[model samples]
Target: MHAPGIWGIIVVAIVVILLFGRGKIAGLMGEVASGIKSFQKGMRDEENKPAAQIDASTTVEPVAQPEKKDA
Candidate 1:
């Protein structure tokens, strides 16, 4: 089927606005915008950081075990 033209899109938009008040639509749009912004920020942060950066203090050394006596 062919895609809806400008008039069809406009009619759909009007119907949606009528069903859900302007305030609710505006709030949803705001939330969507914020989510997109947050995603972009996370992507940028991931790009800047190193793949692996372990601290020396956090590393654990293996402990020595005592030998068992024969029966």
Candidate 2:
């Protein structure tokens, strides 16, 4: 199948806007922008975190059990 040209894309966009209204589209765009921003901030925070803290949070220590003695 042939890929959609610029005109086809524009027509689809217009139809979607007509169906959803401008305000709804704008709000959806705003939500998408905020979600992208939050994801970027989270990535930055993870990169800036201390390696030791990350390691400490993930590592598990083995527990020692008491030796059994036979009577």
Candidate 3:
């Protein structure tokens, strides 16, 4: 009663797909998969990089040094 069953969800999905047509849905899924693969590849390449390289790339220096105040 509280939760909708799986069959009801599947029926709704089928109706939406029928309205949108299969080709459009397939193309969208292909793009999504390509994006995910590229993201994963980037992550793996980062992981495989040397620690020194990562540290150097992410280093930030202070833009302005404060003057010492007179005692």
Candidate 4:
């Protein structure tokens, strides 16, 4: 029945909470949220930066090659 599935989920959740404790769970969630926010901010900053500016001085100059001598 649907009730059994719900109960099973509830039991699993309770077991997980008991194993980790409330404070640990909250701290983990807080850290996850902070990470997500930082990632979003980085993405926004990247979008706001001009693409040309990002790679403005990234040209690779060709290097001179020396002739190889056979032994």
Candidate 5:
């Protein structure tokens, strides 16, 4: 069997709207939009910041350990 046509999709949407009122649907859409905006802002902020810059002055020297003797 094939998938439902336009009418079937419309009927399902109507049922969904009836189950969850317009306000609920609108709130969900708003949340989705805010999340998108937040994601975009984070991406923009990251681009402005330098990537993994290391300072040469602060050097970490390796600790020398005494040679181990076999018992």
Candidate 6:
């Protein structure tokens, strides 16, 4: 099958933008950018954190159960 030409792509983009509106598209783009920045910040924060803290939190602790009482 023949791929869509440049005009086809442009028309699709225009239709999408018209349906969505410029402000809505810009807001969504802003939200996406902020989400990416937040993810990067979280990763950086994790990397900067101490390994001991991470390991300590992840360590499993077993709870002691009381012996069963006979009814």
Q: Per-candidate TM vs. native? A: 0.60, 0.61, 0.57, 0.66, 0.71, 0.70
By lDDT, the better pick of 1 and 3 is 1
Worst 10 residues of 2 by lDDT: 50-59
Alpha-carbon shift of residue 7 in model 1 (angstroms): 4.4
Q: Which segments of candidate 1 are over 4 A away from where they belong? A: 1-7, 53-71
Q: Give the clashing residue pairs of candidate 2, or none.
A: none
Residue 8 of model 2 has an lDDT of 100
lDDT of 4 by residue, 3-71 (tens): 568889999999999999999999999999999999999999999997664576788899999999999
lDDT tens readout by residue for model 6, 1-71: 99999999999999999999999999999999999999999999999997764556578889999999999
Clashes, model 5? 0
Better of 4 and 6 by lDDT: 6
The weakest ten consecutive residues by lDDT in model 1 span 52-61
lDDT of each: 0.96, 0.94, 0.91, 0.93, 0.98, 0.94
lDDT of 1 by residue, 23-61 (tens): 999999999999999999999999999899687888888
Angstrom error at residue 37, model 6: 0.3
Q: Between 1 and 6, whose TM-score is larger?
A: 6
User: Model 3, range 1-71, lDDT digits (tens) per residue?
Assistant: 58879999999999989998999999999999999999999999999997764556677887997999999
Prediction 6 global C-alpha lDDT: 0.94
What is the overall TM-score of model 1 with all chains considered together? 0.60
Model 6 pairs in collision:
none
lDDT of 5 by residue, 1-71 (tens): 99999999999999999999999999999999999999999999999988898999999999999999999
Deviating ranges (above 4 Å) for candidate 4 = 1-4, 53-71
Off by over 4 Å in 5: 55-71
